[model samples]
Target: MTGRIHRTAAGLGPAAPVRAVHLGLGGFHRSHQAWYTAGDPEWGIAAYTFRNTELPRALTEQQGVYTLLVAGEEAEVVGSLSRAHAGADRESWLADLASPDVAVLTLTVTEAAYAVPEPGQDSAVQRVVAGLRARHRSGGAPITVVPCDNVPDNGAVLRSVLRSATRDDRRFAAWVEEQVSVVSTVVDRITPAPTDEDVAAALRATGLRDEAPVRTEPFTEWLLAGDFPAGRPAWERRGARFVPDVGVYQQRKLWFLNGAHSLLAYAGLARGHTTIREAVDDDALAGTVQQWWDTAARHIALDPAEVAEYCRRLRDRFAAPGIRHQLRQIATDGSQKIPARWLPVLRAERAAGRLPGAVVTGLAAWLLHLRGGEVRDPRAAELVESAGSVRRALLALDEEVGADDELVSAVEAELHRT
Candidate 1:
């Protein structure tokens, strides 16, 4: 912990153990999970970005110190963040994974990282398995890999991919199958990408220019089910809920918040909107999102009242004038996201002999976004391969990527119109 940053909550007692490794050290991790970790002295996170070197360099300079501003409905919750290490220091990251001191691996690599293509039939999933195999061979400690992304059955998906990727390694494969636990989770928070102005404001608020600072809406919820082989943070203390089944909770978020977010990204973008706030403020676009949520709420497994409450909360979060979540940022990787976020309910509604109007509209917008040639995004590479066949793309997605004949036809009709 030498030269590392420390942010003490006055009278907050002792620090927790440093026992977890986070794979993607981006803004959301800084704000939500790290924020929760701040309350426990039992775990400190060692964070690694996928391939970028900028965040690590910045944090190294500041001794890994940063601040998280939880902008609430009527107030802001500002606090200093401590107990984090950068993963760019590869030796340290790998060493920690191999140590009993670290018992958990958390991931937030986003939707695309899960499905990147590789030579032959290999993909990024295989690459992750190969990495895990190497670590296992080198005496990496038994631990849990918790995926904090929005996808359903995330843990199972990862486990299948890892097993598939390492089929030849019977010994190694068995070790992973028995010892490695991949936990699925439902994570919710509305954290916008920080702008330069927002960064400056954060610095002035704390008198420190945190190169990797994070800003988020006040509401935060996490539901997880999995066991840690070694140990884990006493995160349950900070309003983190553990349950036998996180299905209902996961569905509530995926369809309402994530699904609505996609609607805003695709449909709103077509309407010349850039930021989520801009899109939500527009009557037509905002209504589109609200109406989608209305139809989607009916499909969720949770109580109608609870879904309604969640939607109300989403409105408040999206209305934040201080947040600057870009439409294009959420708009990217539609190929991966649509299957997880939107398709399930569409398929469900169609199975019940109903038209999935909002879902079809979102699918249409996504197809338009993927049509290629006009929209220029840095992440354009992911959308290129699947541009020609909407049906094939939708079908190839996971089983949970649900849609039926009527729903598919509606989307197809809309795509044709576009």
Candidate 2:
């Protein structure tokens, strides 16, 4: 246990059978889904990462067991991640998907990953389609696809990706129509990008020199809609809720929690704050977050008390100094995140004849953030290279936001606040 100990050598917990396959093997997936799966002894995840090969290599070396650093204190070793592999391990990927034993395939790469794969790039969704197609030829067993990203109707979106990808393959496409049940999920957990202290903390908390420790907040939630046809882990045992519909629940989360987060990430970074704790604790930024929440709360279909409680809890979570959720990390992929988390609020408020001040402010912060040149989006060249292309950049997020002169003016007005 002294130098880079493996899970077997550490004897943390027994690894479960690999009954699940997860794309995007990252900290969020580890802290959230795999953490729940860690509780369910029946299933384990054979997770893969195409982009970050180093992760799979590290996890594989560590025997797919990593410490879950909750609140930067307690380090519980999660062993449900039974196997880790790279996306290029397509043979294994196809085998897992084709096998009737692997019943559920979940993904959380990011909204940017859902875009059509570039030339020679294998997107996560494309890999899923390929796997499912293979499953069809291998005596297709009913499998469930649960999309755990922030995309609205994530399940339907993934389903569309599958359908569009397999349109020429008539037999496989029909098999998909019958065999796949894409489940939409609303997942919440604040898993910051790991810091250098994480490795040291894991070693201190668990007598093991771990490399891939997942540091996350104490708060977590998972609400799902749709059936697990072949079978799935009893995720409910680990506080996961399976509901008839996750539509309203998703909106509440996307508009309120994620929307506020986008605001904080941009505005906080602009204000020279580094982490969520610093940003949320700042009086001015805190007030802006509250305003954004109030604006979104007007549209969320949840009870006022419930929304208030959720916001209260969010403040507590955000204020936890231990969380250390980085504003810059959250700031990445602003183009994708803005459309998902802020566009609805912007459009709704404008249509209601009330301009969303906080939304405008967040947009201004984001545009300025773009011009500051730390942007990590697919459209980085067009949007971030020059400051004069404000309309082009705004249009990239939404046509309405781009076209509305008043909204554009409001954002421009806020941009001058500095």
Q: What is the C-alpha local distance difference test score of each model?
A: 0.69, 0.86
lDDT by residue for model 1 over 92-189, one digit each (tens)?
66566666677777888776666534546333354356547656877856888888887777777777767666677799888888878888888887
Give me the runs in candidate 1 sitting further than 4 Å from their true place: 1-17, 72-89, 115-131, 134-140, 372-418
Query: For model 1, what is the alpha-carbon lDDT of residue 157?
Result: 73
Q: Which ten residues in a row have the lowest lDDT in candidate 2?
A: 113-122
Cand. 1 Cα-lDDT: 0.69
1-418: candidate 2 lDDT, tens digit per residue: 2877576667766678889999988999999999998878889899988867888999988988888999846678888888999878999999999989999998988988776554465778678878988888899999999889999888888888778777877988898998899999999999999888999999988888888998998889999999888988989888999998999988988888888888999999999998888998899999999998998888878899999998998888889877888888888888888888988887788889999888888988898898887788877887776445666668777877788888877777787776
Clashes of 2: 0
